[model samples]
Target: MREIYNELKRHSGKLTEFAQVLVDRGLYTNTKHCVAMMRHSTQFRQDVQDIYAEWKPGKLKTKDTATHNAKLAEVFRSIKKKELKEKVETMCEILEETLMTVTLAIKHSDVRKLGEVKANIENILYGEKQ
Candidate 1:
């Protein structure tokens, strides 16, 4: 749980701490609602188990990414292949750009931009040019 919260923090600052607090409160509120619903509705109680199933894989993914990224960073620090380093650096930039763009698209409900991102990812993965 501490690691999970630290992962949520992602960076150090008072604002980040405040953000965590806000997230905690939001979760608390939603959990209370869920409990109330569960008491009142059989469907809500049964349906909530699926949410846990979905979240379990995501939690594992979060931990796995942290481990994977640390190893990648370590490898990059010792790696002697300039070409591989340059390619990895370029890929990192592409990933950062995609992360930001996809986040903004989802936040704004921009379906068209999301579709474009899908095509971009496909092109990158399959060696197809737009």
Candidate 2:
């Protein structure tokens, strides 16, 4: 049970880090940005789901232990909820940043610059920094 809690805590921390990364590099306004964000979101969700599934079994098996199970359930629920909220907030921040980048690029008469920036940002976000 302690091990399970530790795993949940680790995953939650990773998800929080991923969200922060998304928020930090919210400057893509082209195909790269869209693709990178999509991939990141997909992977993050998969990771969260996997962690939840792992906890679910333990939670079920220990249902007879109401106090222990209830504590586990509460931790699971709280962490998952906070992870989701952070995900949404970070996603929105990314979108807003992308839109702002596009607007600025178009206004400055630099469409090509926008594309370059977008691709670079995507590379950074997706860890394809080559």
TM-score of each: 0.35, 0.39
Which residue pairs show backbone clashes in model 2? Answer: none
Instruction: Report the lDDT tens digits of candidate 2 across residue range 1-130.
Output: 2333344345435333433433454533454453345444433445434544653553332235878889999999999999989977776677677777888888988777687667745854674664
The per-prediction tally of clashing pairs is: 0, 0
Candidate 2 regions exceeding 4 Å error are 1-64, 116-130
The top-ranked prediction according to lDDT is 2
- For candidate 2, give the lDDT: 0.56
Error of 2 at 119 (Å): 4.1
Which one wins on TM-score? Answer: 2
What is the Å distance of residue 81 in model 2 from its true position?
0.9
